[model samples]
Target: MVELAETVSDVARSEDRKEFDALVQRYHKQAYNIAYRMAGNHADAEDLTQEAFIRAFRFFGQYRRELPFDSWLYKIMSNVFIDRLRRKPKAMIRSLDQPVVTSEGEAQFDVPDNSAGPEETVLSREMDSRIQAALDTLPEAFRLTVIYADIEGMSYEEIAESTSTNIGTVRSRLHRGRRLLRNKLKSYANQLV
Candidate 1:
């Protein structure tokens, strides 16, 4: 990574396109999700993700291999996506009303039939939808930190490094972000009861 980071300013960095390609292959999904987590829509995610990789390659020399390469890449992707999103402030709010897209084309959430009435079943599903919406409503930085640390299963140190934030801020953001999400979710909690 030290060598890679040096590549950023060192005019004579490694010219091995294959090596960089390999790195891309390894992190494509990770990068895409960070974009998705930041940008929300698949179309925007695709564009932002591609642009991030392009930017990374353009600045590959700055990559410090001593640090985690994945973290650096994620930071780049998150920043790019968030920046693009920042340009379209209205888009983010409009996206909240967008439909949920579940992977595998099937619902993973099961409304346990613990005597759930038809109304209860519907309410449960609505709550689930609202939770997803609230998550999307969160600010990009807070959302990405929480998604990486919780949904994507990254550690605090990893998240902090990726976001260029300190561990304490990472923890604080995660806590506050979830708290805000819960508050948003509470608006629909009556449906749960």
Candidate 2:
């Protein structure tokens, strides 16, 4: 019945356990996706979200009254992601070596296939798989921009703030990231044909 902003602000100001729990209940799943976008993996996403909440809870007292709580929470999430990135050893995206294949007509990555000849149905699945895989190749900043704008349907300004980048950077990253994805998909379009 309560709006997320009010609930979060109250909990932050008062340390209201019930209100805070409601905030968690409402935002947990959505927060997970944000973390996943930033972290680029399931395991890391979970950790990032949990860490964000822990950090946010610890400092809820300091949350400003006029600011939207989700934005504040998201700011905390950004810190968590940056910290995770700094702490972990940077590694190449793990999906590039894998062949994107699927029984369905859609796929995430387009790997060179020796399937002899795949039917339209097979190709569709492969394309879908290749698309997803190609997406995973992007850097966390670019990846979060794409997911927030395209998948979550946030505005450029919202994504820029959530990502701690300027709108120009968000636009540039989204444009460049999508181009890179399309090129990745183009590699296996022959399979679709």
Give the Cα error of residue 15 in candidate 2, in Å.
3.4
TM-score of 2: 0.65
lDDT of 1: 0.73
List the lowest-lDDT window of 10 residues for candidate 2: 114-123
Candidate 2 lDDT by residue in tens digits, 1-193? 4698888777656655655677789888888877765665677778999998889878766767587778778778767776786688865664544655777754555455422465634436445455656776776677767877876798999887877879999899999988887787786766745
- Regions of model 1 farther than 4 Å from truth: 1-14, 92-129, 187-193
- Clash count in backbone of candidate 1: 8
Off by over 4 Å in 2: 1-14, 90-129, 188-193
- How does each model score on TM-score? 0.67, 0.65
Cα RMSD to the true fold for all candidates: 9.4, 9.5
